[model samples]
Target: MTVKTRIYLVRHGETAWNAGGKFQGHSDIPLSERGRKQAKALAERLSNLKIDAFYSSDLSRARETAGILAEPHRGTVYYLPELREINFGRWEGLTFKEIAEAYGELSTRWWASPLTIQIPAGESLQQVVDRCTRAVAGIITRHAGETVVVAAHGGVIRVIVGAALGLDLNHFWQLRLDNVSLTVLEYHGPEKAILELFNDTCHLHEK
Candidate 1:
């Protein structure tokens, strides 16, 4: 029987920037109280699953969310900078409207063709795809037939999913991943994988 490795791709809980519609990029913002509550709810949702490993962006938001999710299983989270969000460069704390006003057509062009345009000091979508995929590749190699949890930022998770499905990087924007959402990818081999779930936030339902 060919064993497939299942990866629970998660977006970190909400942050102040997230609530304010600011670009978090590589900013090291921590989760808010609501974000922590969201993480707790997600943790309860996955408490019964047999998770073999846990990975997360080195950012405090993702780190804290991973910590909460792993609390039930006694899992140690492997933090990686590569799993961090697309470096928004100089636009780290600005909203999209602010970016558009400040950057003019450049921002519009970037939104339309992210793969081709570089973000002033931030990373292009292609560059993000390269590094994030490399990191996930290593994780899949180490645990070929097991299940793992990868908690990261929304943009990072989108690119990883885009690459997995062989979609153009531009489509990354179209894939809307909610904070603390669950997205699963099952990999049977390096080139063979399946997106079992995407953006499942059913766990956030009112208690």
Candidate 2:
């Protein structure tokens, strides 16, 4: 019998750029006002869970969200730079429309087949997968049979969940993760994983 490892994957709360539909990429953007509220609500909802560890991306937005979520628990957060979002490079801070207008073909390819498209001077989907996988694998190995929380960017969360589902980089866009949303994944072993929950926002609905 194999022990089941559970991970509560959370996308950091919204940033000013996120609200504006701008590419945050690896930029160190802080959370907006609404994002802070969302994080508080999320913390309240997750306060009851028996989480053994808390991890977060080194970015400010993710780290801030993780701080709120960690308040009810041990109040400790381990930062992992590898869990940061896909580096959008030149595209960072640009809105969707601006990106499309500036880099037409590249933007089109990005939406159409993100796995095959690499942003100008930025990291590729394969790179994101590789690093995120190593970080996730390490987390699972260190805390086998326990539940842990990982607060990261939308792209990183999506990739991590996709990898856990055994999906390749091509299917990356299939999973959508909203800000402050919760996704639960259980790993039976390196080869066996299950998606118990995906993009759960019920906590945000609570008063």
Candidate 3:
């Protein structure tokens, strides 16, 4: 039997910026009270899983969420900067409306063709796909046949899932990853990754 490695891809809990619909790209904001509660709920939801490894983006929000989820299993979370959200540069901390008001056509293009649109001084979606997928590849290789958890940003998780499904950067916005949502990916081999779950937020119902 071929061993399949399972990856539980979790988007970090809600943040103040998330509630405000502000761009939180690489901002290092801590989780809000609601976010903390959401993380704890998600932790409880996954407490029974046989997780072999835990990993997270180095950002505080993701790190804290991973910390919560790792508690039940007594696991150490491996922090990877490569899993950080796409850097929004000037767009960081701004709302979509604000971005549209400030950047006009550039912001429109960012929404329509994020794969090709560059954020003034931030990373393009392709760049996010490259770095985040590389970290995922490393995790899969390191923990083959084992179940691992990765807590990261919405944008980061989206790119990783899309990549696993052979979807390119153009479909970036299609993967709707909500805060504290859970996604599962099973890797049987390099080209045999299956998206078992996507954006599951049932645990948050307890909140």
Candidate 4:
């Protein structure tokens, strides 16, 4: 029987920026009080799972969320900087309307053609895919056949899932990753991967 490595991809809990609907790409903002409570609740929901390893983006929000989950299992948490959110360049911290007002048609084109268009002073969707793919590949290689949890941003989670499914980066928005949501992926061999779940927020019902 082929051993399958299970990966739990979790999006970090909400932050102040998330509540405000602002683009928080690459920002090091900490989680809001609600976010902290959500993480704790998620920890409780996952308490019974035997996690072999835990990993997270280096950003404060993701790191803290991972810490909360890891505390119960005492699992080793690894920080992967490459798992950080996509750089929004000059558009960082801007709301959707603000970006449209500032860049007009350019912003529309960016949303419509993210994979091909590069954000001025930031990364393109393809660039994000490359970085996230590298980080995921590295983790899978190191922990094959084990259950691992990776806490990261929504954007990063989208790209990682896309790459695993062999989908184009332009279709990244199709994957809806909510704050504190969990996605599960399984790797059966050197090249085969399966997405078992996406954007599961069942724990939020307890909140």
TM-score of each: 0.98, 0.95, 0.96, 0.96
- Candidate 1 is scored at a TM of 0.98
On lDDT, the stronger of 1 and 4 is 1
TM-score, model 4 to reference: 0.96
Ranking by lDDT: 1, 3, 4, 2
Model 1, which residues run further than 4 Å from truth? Answer: none
Better-scoring candidate (lDDT), 3 or 4: 3
- lDDT per residue, candidate 3, 1-207, as tens digits? 777899999999899999999999989999999999999999999999899999999999999999999999999999999999999999999998999999999988888889878998898898898898789888988998999999999899888888888886676787788999999999986557988999999998844
lDDT of 4 by residue, 28-116 (tens): 98999999988998999999999999999999999999999999998878999999999898988899999999999889898888988
> Candidate 4, which segments miss by more than 4 Å at Cα?
none
Residue 148 of model 1 has an lDDT of 95
- Best lDDT among the predictions, by candidate number: 1
State which candidate, 2 or 4, has the greater lDDT: 4
Indicate the residue-level lDDT of 79 in model 1.
95
Q: What is the lDDT of residue 33 in candidate 1?
A: 99
Residue 79 lDDT in model 2? 97
lDDT agreement with native, every candidate: 0.93, 0.89, 0.91, 0.90
Least accurate 10 contiguous residues by lDDT in model 1? 168-177
Judged by whole-model lDDT over C-alpha atoms, candidate 1 comes out at 0.93
lDDT of 2 by residue, 1-93 (tens): 998999998999998899899999998999999999999999999999898999999999999999999999966999999999999999999
